[model samples]
Target chain A: MTIFNRLNPGNTANAAPNPQGRQTMPDNTANQATAPESKRPQAVAQPLYAAAGTGGPMTSVISKALKITGQLESTENIQVDGQIEGDVRGLSVKVGNGARVKGTVYGDEVELAGTVDGKIEAKKVVLTGTARMQGDVIHQDIRIESGAYIDGHCKPDFGKGGKASQPSLKAVAGEKTSAA
Target chain B: MPHVTHLCIIPFGVRRGLSLESETPFMFTLARTVNGKPAFARGADQDVSHLGPGLTATGLFETDGELYVYGAISGRVDAARLIIAPGGVVDGDVVAQDVRIAGRFSGRIFAPHVTIDETGNVKGRVFHTTVTVAHGARIDGRMPWRPQSYFETLKELPETYA
Candidate 1:
């Protein structure tokens, strides 16, 4: 529970605790064209922790047809093969080849293979081939491959005075250190 | 079926990073139905977008292909075919052609065809033309019925609800 000090995914469920008590859903088969896929929830760790915002290390994919005009904030990995017009904050953000972004990107690790028209603030940054950047990049570690075009300076001050890394991530890190 | 080629283009669309238009190779595949018609008996290649369990996203997402959510997303999602795998959680409004949920969803949904699996925990409203709710699914809201035409003309979602 302490792992997600900022982003809590269980708040809604806890707020409405079992409103449908013993009320069985009707057996309606007319609308069911396909049978249920076998995707049972695994009996893993505590549901509270495992189902929290601090997901394991899985990645999220953003398809090409999708476009986001608002801010995208996540506590996990994100792969973007789409177009984004706002800020993106994630753990590890990967801008796929030919994708387009028009705002800042914040993450612990960020890899860009697309076109970015704004800034990037991260601990580690990688710009692969086919990347076209038009703004500055603030990172602690950076790698730029050949064929990547950049039109701005690369600053090595990520958490100095710029956008601070997510506090929830710090808490996660703190827990990992204490556990180790 | 003739639609198998369209189904194959879902993953190819993701790989090509093509813009939203008819120029992409994925568009020709969706020629049969484009106007929010609920997906039915689609090909086995129903998974194109995957959000793994360790990810969380907030904002609006729009797509014309298949999507699988095993993570957490809070916002608006518009897609053709969507599957919320077990352990996934979505808290927002969704306008999907075909939606299948095996996880937890708390919000308003407008779709032509909807499926709620046994492990699903849903709270709020579901506007559908055809819906199937499996046993052991927990619902704490309303499942309002709507005509297929209602979804076909749903090009512009009302900003009041979502």
Candidate 2:
């Protein structure tokens, strides 16, 4: 019985009722034990995500086997190595080799080494040697590698023409378009 | 009397080791058990997907392999195995062969095997063939058991709960 209690500390309250046949004693102990166990998960859960990386926020990884069919928005960095059929918004977005995106990508910095069938809007854009972009790119700064394949216009117009008005308008318009 | 003391001390040492192992993140341990292999046995580059923190994805995610979510997702997910890490939040239906939830899940789960960790907070029906719920897990809905065939023939998720 002691071994059983040691194995399952949470079951102590349940075992008490069976052994002592005292209902009130078990109830009070159960409440006390449960109250802390419920809160402990939250505190303990934080370390798992933290341990995934060195420090700071961890970058989201969309691995190659996954396929997503909707909008992805992240405040932190995003690394895409899979397939996405909708818009993507992030601080720093990296489209890895063999990955594919069929819609617009919005980020502060965007790097592409895969295939994008739609648009890209960012403050800084880097098209690696393996990038295959088939639509327009709007960026404040752009770099296209020698082997990159681009089939559309490259416009250096990101964050231009009334910066404040453009961002709000673009955000509203982007959401409306995606919804429709 | 010395033999009795030795027996007690050994079990105490073993119990301490077990408690320490349990403190390791639930997702990592659950993944290895369900896969029946080391978590990274499959080369680190493929067959597994990770949705890291601070990501909010709203869509349908379909994968033939494993999926580990540490972020938030509000859509349908179909995978061979799904692990909701402790900080993750998923608010939609999930169809998988195996599912281990250590986070907040607010939708129905259709799986052959389902395990809810102590940190899991689940609020919808769980249709599982085999289920395990750890102590301290908060589940606010019914868990209905089904035969193994019930999951093998599940081509599409039911639109509404029966």
Best by lDDT: 2
Q: Candidate 2: DockQ?
A: 0.33
- TM-score per prediction, in order, is 0.65, 0.72
Q: Identify the runs in model 2 with alpha carbons over 4 angstroms from their true place.
A: A1-54, A161-179, B1-44
Give the DockQ (C-alpha) for candidate 1.
0.25
lDDT of 2 by residue, A22-122 (tens): 54555677688889877865675555444444557678878776778878888889889888888888889999998999988889999999999998989
- Candidate 2 differs from the real structure by a C-alpha RMSD in angstroms, to one decimal, of 13.5
Model 1, range A1-180, lDDT digits (tens) per residue? 354422333344333443454111211221232233333333221342243345357677776656655566667788888777767778899998968888788899999999999888889999998999999998999999999999999988877763444444444435535754
Clashing pairs in 1: none
Candidate 2 per-residue lDDT, tens place, B45-119, comes to 676787877788887886656788888999888766888988889999998778888889998998878989887
Q: How accurate is candidate 1 locally (lDDT)?
A: 0.69
Which lDDT value does model 2 have at B10?
23
Native-referenced TM-scores of chain A, all candidate models: 0.61, 0.67
In model 2, the fraction of reference contacts reproduced equals 0.74
Shift in Å, residue A144, candidate 2: 0.5
TM-score of chain B of each: 0.70, 0.72
- Residue B40, candidate 1: Cα error in Å is 16
